[model samples]
Target: MNKTFKIYAVIFIIIMVILALLEVSKKEVTDWRKNFDVNEKSPFGLFVFNKEIKDLFKNNFTKIDVTPYDYYSEKNKKPHNILVVESEVDQESWNKILDEVSKGSDAMIIATRIPKNISDSIGFYNSKISFEEQNVLKLTDKKYQNDFIELDKFPSGRGFSYIKPNVQVLGKTVEKNNEDQANFIKATFGKGNIYVHCEPLFLTNYYLLKSGNVKYAQSIFSYLGDKETIWFVESNTKESSSLLRFILANPALKYAWWVFLGGIVLFIFFNVKRKQRIVPIIEPLKNTSADFVKSIGNLYLQEGDFHDMMAKKAQYFLNKVRLDLLIDTQNLDEEFSKKLQLKTGKSAELVNEAISLIKKAQDPYAGVMKEDLGRMNKLLDGILK
Candidate 1:
């Protein structure tokens, strides 16, 4: 049994060591999952175009950073071009964007999924298009027909379907199967136009670096036309603090945080001592004198030593009389009874009865019965009361 236990313990230790090494050596991959956050440094982020796009607008327009709530506010209502990129747009933000665009501010949205209100307002709906093999994209305009543009990595992106008659197709996906799907469209709102692009990954860093793909991205920008001022709406989000972000980014630190929380729980479970009251050391009340006399009388009765029990009772009664009444108990005559009656304020009959019982109890050869003992107890009780 001991050998088997040792082998199991060794195996556990080796497994733990391997897991710890893996945890330590594991590197966090650059998250290429498309978030479209312009501030993020990931490959799918828009950090590379931050300088170039801002410089592009520097000569003709001023760049401003705003949120959906801020841009819709009354105090900041300037007619400028709006750019938004998100994974999923909510109804409220979509409505606000439509309202802003209807007021003659051109808006361009690059997202995987657009909300129902925005899609309905633009007269188009988006659907997922999956390519079993690699595919390339082509602009529907004749001017960009020869441009080489390929979306080789992202096999699953979005495409526009059920486009209304009023909407114009801007670009389409070119697959070897000849299954060309519309992915970009331009629709007219109240006074301004809304350009909806289904594939936002085309603007990401990975595809932007592809050969001759920059021209494809640049062609999509031309739809904005001469509306110079640009308002980039940052997604409304609760960003994590620097320390928390670091802990989440590192696996070892995240594990250490969990271990620390577990230690706290264990400490509270083991160390939350319950406060208890101090127990008092109470000495049992010293056996009362009356109880002691009753116990001795019971012992004498058990042994059938009634004469001795009577003698002890008489002696104790006389002693109590002498101490409490300050009267002599040497004699048991009429004179003694009278003195006891006067001192204790007892009736003469009660005092005489007690004296007579004491005299009977003092006789050495007297035979005491249960009736005689009960009568003596009654007489003594009357006198004492």
Candidate 2:
């Protein structure tokens, strides 16, 4: 290969080598984003919970990709218990879930904040821990009613400031102020019941893997009915509306995007490093304005069309008069001659003579030869100048 090609090839190879080394040596970072992805193995991800949830519930646990509304409305299969774990449930899906619930499908929503419709209808709202970094969580069941798990920092939990009397409080947490706040509850709607829990972080991989919190987490899931459950995986949303994140979220597209970025980096590095000499800008050949006028004049002269040429010259002179002198030459009469003289400060004789030639040129019957054309041109030029 040529020397320049060899240099570029070496640079490309070196860049690729560095990138590969960097990627290989990179430390694995613990992703703490609370996206609740069942496939993710991060601290806050639910990968561990998803694997063990079937054994915990004593049912066929499956992660569904569609919304609860779609699963319930479209399919004719037997009802499956639905679990929604999200930071917050939007109103639209909340309404759809309620519709499905009215049809006798049980759904449990565990979120940091309850939907407005649920809060307004059921009167269960989120509450803050009344104390410091740690809170004592308890189950209200007869067997474990007095048992409480102490967590390092329980920023969020289900039982809060208000609980409607109809709903049964299954679990609660005690703060530093010695007041018990409900975090888990069951409320009936139509033919089915919804288990609404305030704290979603309780069931994540961190709590499940650390400090025997798995027992407490399972205690909470025991409240769900004994049936096959479908974890509507839409609740694992990253809560990002960006287009790039959407592309990066898919595995196939994510690698394709990285490859595209690598190509762009190579293109920028090699192309920018090898700069080209300034190319002399050959100025486009100028077109003289006189060339167009000369060509038209020559065509008229060769055709021996003196009358046409005279008509054209008179038209040009009238346009000039209107533009430069601001005088109308439409009539070309005595009044026009007077106005032209007043506008141009020209002699009345010159103006009248020019008007007479223009009138002859404009008239069809007034046939003109080459001699007449020359006289008209000379007189018109004198008046206009």
Winner by TM-score = 2
What global local distance difference test value does model 1 have?
0.73
Residue-wise C-alpha lDDT for candidate 2, range 115-223, written one tens digit per residue? 5557656556645545446777788888976445676644553357777788888888767756678887888887788888777777788878877688787777776
For model 1, where is the 10-residue window of minimal lDDT?
A: 230-239
Q: Note the residue pairs that clash in candidate 2.
A: 158-198, 159-182, 159-183
Q: For candidate 2, which ten residues in a row score worst on lDDT?
A: 150-159
Query: Model 1: per-residue lDDT, tens digit, 192-257?
Result: 889887777777777766677778777887778676655454544324578978896887788677
* TM-score of structure candidate 2: 0.56
Error of 2 at 142 (Å): 3.3
Model 2, position 291, has a per-residue lDDT of 95
What do the candidate models score in CA lDDT, each in turn? 0.73, 0.75
Candidate 2 segments whose C-alpha is farther than 4 A from its true place: 17-21, 60-62, 76-80, 87-92, 129-131, 146-148, 157-159, 235-385
Off by over 4 Å in 1: 1-20, 27-32, 50-52, 59-70, 146-148, 228-239, 247-385
Model 2 C-alpha lDDT versus the unseen true structure: 0.75
